[model samples]
Target: MLGQIDITRRQAEIADIVQRSGFASVEELAERFEVTAQTIRRDVNGLCELGILRRTHGGVEPPASAGNIHYSTRQILNLAQKKLIADLVAADVHDGQSLAFSIGTTPEIVMQALTGHEGLCVFTNNLNVAFTASANPSCQVTIAGGRLRPGDRDVVGRSAYDFFTHYKVDIGIFGVAGVDEEGTLLDFHEDEVSARQSILANCRKSFLVLDHSKFGRTAHVRGGHIRDVSCIYTDRPVPQHIQALLEGSETRVVAAQDTV
Candidate 1:
């Protein structure tokens, strides 16, 4: 029962749980507020339908979907810029190259730029990217085995982890939730971290593609530091101090602004 709680209050509570705990389990939630599991299920279902929550095995999580960038959101959100970066990155791919792609909006843009490629094997942890590219005859897309991630469009987990252990690729194109002088790449979800780590292991080179906004931001899970990367492509050049910190390391700072 709602117990006289206003709709706003209920929503506030839901938001609190998702933000603080990552996800809220159905059974625990049912008993916490004197409701049946079914009622809590319905509540969660309502939230999912409304795009406020994402359903996972035993609960709901925020940041809402594993493929956080929905098809609709991808259409309207910083799309032209993503396309620009994608076009540049796509130009770097040669025929018959083996590549691994991480799941992110920018990488998806990369896939779009590769619309007419042939004789290339593109391995991915992203179900969305895989689906988008699967129909193309010129490109072969492989989806690593894994558990599907919620609020994000990738498949991750043990199966995906194991598959990457034996496969090596020429490059891994990754995204970050944030980048810091500490050299760490961060993302909002731990599952995403695992997928990134696994992908990194299977690739000969790691390339991070992030927009200027992602710099200096903080995310909960750190994938690795810049020392672990071969290059980072961003919208603008990084500050000088930050460049010095990465000098003599594997990291090469490339700015799209310089190309323009």
Candidate 2:
């Protein structure tokens, strides 16, 4: 329960966190706004429902896309880092390459970076991704048809999955919510796992473009082991043990920011 003044202040505080940190947590927000955790939860729930902040487990991150693409309770996150990684991944693409891009912030960056590449084909379930790629004359892009997610411009569900079954690509690239000690990719939804599995099965090669913070973490659902991927592009030098596990599984780890 919160007094009117307290509630107003907390809401503004949550907005401030989203505006500044790009993400913030219930507990941290509670402490900052000098309110109870329950009050923060209420604010977060209400604000997310209102499209003021994106919410996530323990916190919130920025939406990958704005407008009709807002989904979940997660707040803003790691925009600069995501952009950096996107530029790096884009550099790997060339003319006449086909790529499968998934629905994630980093993938959005990759799409932006590829706007000028010629003769590129992009297959994506993310409407924004497909739209972004299509804008570049260099790309011939197709979107997977499915029920669109409210918060994300992703066309998830049966139709999209079925669409994926119809085509093969040179590479499938995506970012995961987490990476495990066993070197598996993990996420928050089973359908996403299923979609990625289909991508892995169909693509000639696959890539996991992740940031360092994702290493040694686990989300609610398991995507697959690292070896299931052809390569992992990341921004950090992985821990020795994680590096060894990746090597053991024959998954090449490419530090996206590495000068070499």
Candidate 3:
């Protein structure tokens, strides 16, 4: 019986499952581990104590409130959806347009998608986006001066915020960690949040690119208000409440799957 497994080993497995799926109900975890619900609960409680998982209403999920997932991990998760969202956002961009990109996996994908576009001058705090956008010989890339965050490979600080204040762009593309029920955009870093706020304010048109997983998630910093975005390009429909919120604010919603 799986009941004979080592408690420590089983707990690790549970952590992996919760991290992978984002959330797992106690009953589901219990069945998978071939243990009683009480046993699974104990394992989950122990993991929670260790801060490996966070308890949810009926289950447990990865500890996300502290910060964002690692950049490497985010790059691999929901990859297909990210690609689709990128394509949708890119369609709105044209040659000779000035663009501003925010730091995020989805924005990186958008940069890759724009690799061949000509006469584009891009400004960004994301090193990866700046580098990728520069791959198109005709595109000029500008990096904002700020405190470089090696882990996320992005720059953010008062300097980055000041950098964006000097010029307005034709389009601003960004990704957020979460869009809560109240239609607030949120992220994990204070400097990054401030940088995005500057980008949004300085751009003529602002697009928010995100996968469906961002819905209902939580991030500690307030990025901005959803009403400020010109349009949202996502792989799937946003939550019904969010949709209504956008409509009321005169923001457009582009569901990539439906468009294709």
Candidate 4:
């Protein structure tokens, strides 16, 4: 039996890991903490009740939205790499080209990179992206209408999907939480997935911006397949299996300052 202080500290550590990794299994958390599975389950249940964690199939994850990890945490996770990929993708955007920005830290960085572009029409479900891009003197920013996620400052659901259906953009910029072995794009929320699918179906060309950390990660929902993307911009090399999939499909991989 652990003391109150010990239990508190251990739970805190467990929450930190789940926030950083996006997901953690009960058995793995048990082994890592040197505790029995039953004990870990108790801790997870408590955390879930407190709204610090969400129960998944055989593990726990950060809450789907609003209760997700902080934007600051997401911002700092891959700052340098995100900036590199943002620069590479932004360079592709020409003046007067219309673009849609998805909800993610990477898309926010890309919005920053697009500052001062002339005659550009930008549509986004991310409130942060809309506000930031609005600061560009020559850009027109349109935000999707829907239930807002105060946590991430984004919009989702049918309203957002309907908004995207009205206009087809020249470019669609998106981010994913995971890319599975078969090259499917995965994310945490089904509503966001639906929004992404709408953007993919309407856009002339689509680009996925991601870091290497997403390579083997797992998420609950599938947004779409990689073959639907026109290109992928990343800060690291694509893993061999994913690379093979891209090569056999229509997707082109763009690596920035990649070592692997």
Q: Judging by lDDT against the true structure, name the best candidate.
A: 3
Q: Rank candidates, lDDT, best first.
A: 3, 4, 2, 1
Candidate 4: pairs in clash = none
* lDDT of each residue in 49-89, candidate 2, tens digit only: 66566778898755555322233222224444556677777
Question: Of the candidates shown, which would achieve the greatest TM-score relative to the real structure?
Answer: 3
Candidate 4 lDDT tens digits, 129-180: 8888777778898899879887678898899988899999999999988888
Q: What are the C-alpha RMSDs, in order, of all predicted structures?
A: 11.3, 8.6, 8.4, 8.9
Residue pairs of candidate 3 with colliding backbone atoms: none
Please report how far candidate 4 places residue 5 from its true position, in Å. 31
What candidate 2 gets wrong by more than 4 Å, as runs, is: 1-76
Q: Report lDDT (CA) for all predictions.
A: 0.71, 0.72, 0.84, 0.83
How well does model 3 score by local distance difference test?
0.84
Give the runs in model 3 whose Cα sits over 4 Å from its true position: 1-66
Residue 52 in candidate 1, Cα distance off native in Å:
10
Shift of residue 96 alpha carbon in model 3, Å: 0.8
lDDT of 2: 0.72
Q: Which ten residues in a row have the lowest lDDT in candidate 1?
A: 1-10
Worst 10 residues of 3 by lDDT: 1-10
